[model samples]
Target: MATADPSNSSSAFAQLTNILLAKGGYESDEAWKFVEDLFKNIDGKVLSSSSSVYKSVADGEMVVGLSYEDPCVTLEKDGAPVNVVYPSEGTVYLPANAGIIKNAKHMDNAKKFIDYLQSQDCQDNLGLTTTNRPVLKDVQIGDIMKPISEIKTLKEDSEYVIAHKDDIVDHYKEIYTSISSEK
Candidate 1:
């Protein structure tokens, strides 16, 4: 297991929730409620950084049951062999999506921009630099992202969970207030 500092409340809870939502397909509002409930049950303060969480865990500063991701974790970073867990409970997978704005003045340019982004060269660059899983079938990006074989993708026919965008944002605002009041 990777390590994190429990006292480092900078990014722990938020990053955990973000990753969980990405894997669980929770709508933003549902995600907010889930996180709120999660924090309400935990004793420690939530930090904003995973690095802090990792350190805290590593140093035995805190204990939590969660998983994390970092593309840079490799033998070079002295990272231990850890498998990315896919809970039987379920997860959400957010593919890198791109689209042109309907009313943009540079419609043609926007199309070209999207095309460029999806090109093999750009995909390779993104794979090399980030955790982005390329959608293009032809792009042979290796070493930069988890191999396609290793990924546990959501079923193509799975039902989508849509969150009320406005409600999600507003709920998070209240959750933040609740968190602050507890301090």
Candidate 2:
């Protein structure tokens, strides 16, 4: 299995943590224990970036990866043999939000940008040109990208994630370091 190094990609690391916690029914306190056992038991590869994880899988260097969905969809659309699985235990979907800041220097431009961002034309472009799952329900996505409604999403506990994020990063680093040293 492959994963992004925690220090290099905290967002990817957070996603992986969400998967591990949900999949094994492990609490925040026991995250370290579970992560340690995972790396120790599995043939794990910690890459520098999320892209590296996908590249490893694509090159057949790794059988599976705890990576993002966008690249997988992109790869599949390009005819690469890849199976994107949303863990049955549940996985979090990262939502992108856009808003204009208060007292902006260019209020008119900001409004225009926000309007353009919300427009169906832009949303459709996001869905078609990129692997981004469009927020607009009416926008059609690429053939390989699964609709958000089709995914079994995990109800994120924002407070818990925010509170434990630092601890998760620290423990992951320690565990990864220890495992790397042992090898």
Candidate 3:
């Protein structure tokens, strides 16, 4: 029952739909219908963060998580009684992006910084500090972190996600909020 701010691009529904679409490749329409059912099923169960979801689990407020991998890793490192499940149904991959501003006064510097973020050292440092997987190939994951290669992932289309994120967010607002309002 872990949730994000509906407007949080990090927790966009596009990835969910992309994942479900992968899972239901032969019947994408049904995949979308199932996603709607999923949101309804999860309506009242939403928790604000991975920690909140972990607290809910600890307090017996919920039985499972539908959240990111980071908190579970953090909790496990702290030795709280919890486990992370990379769903057998397959997980989703959505990378955080770093972009340079258009027409910036220091375009080269901006470009340099973005490039550094993509570099092996910076990415590995990011993994160590944040306990999330680094994008650079074969960087070791933190001990509690799930090795990225092991998870059967639904690789989302960056182009499509970039193009249609707003629509997806709006659709989430429409359906999920409508459920809450009705209830």
TM-score pick, better of 1 and 3: 3
Candidate 3 stretches greater than 4 Å from native: 1-9, 12-15, 25-27, 43-51, 101-116, 166-183
Pairwise lDDT winner, candidates 1 and 3:
3
lDDT of 2: 0.76
For model 2, how does the per-residue alpha-carbon lDDT over 89-128 read when each residue is reduced to its tens digit?
6778766799989999999999999999989999998898
- Please give each candidate's TM-score: 0.48, 0.82, 0.70
Total backbone clashes of model 2?
0
For residues 105-141, could you state the per-residue lDDT of candidate 1 as single tens digits? 9998999999999888998776676555566765665
Which residue pairs clash in candidate 3?
none
Better of 1 and 2 by TM-score: 2
Candidate with top TM-score is 2
Query: What lDDT would each prediction earn against the true structure?
Result: 0.51, 0.76, 0.66
TM-score of 3: 0.70
In model 1, what lDDT does residue 147 have? 64
lDDT of 3 by residue, 1-183 (tens): 555444553543433655455668323666656666877877744555445656676556677655566666777688767788776767776777778778999999999998998888888888777867787887755667778778888766677656776776676666677778877
Backbone clash numbers for all candidates listed: 26, 0, 0
Q: Candidate 2 at residue 108, lDDT?
A: 100
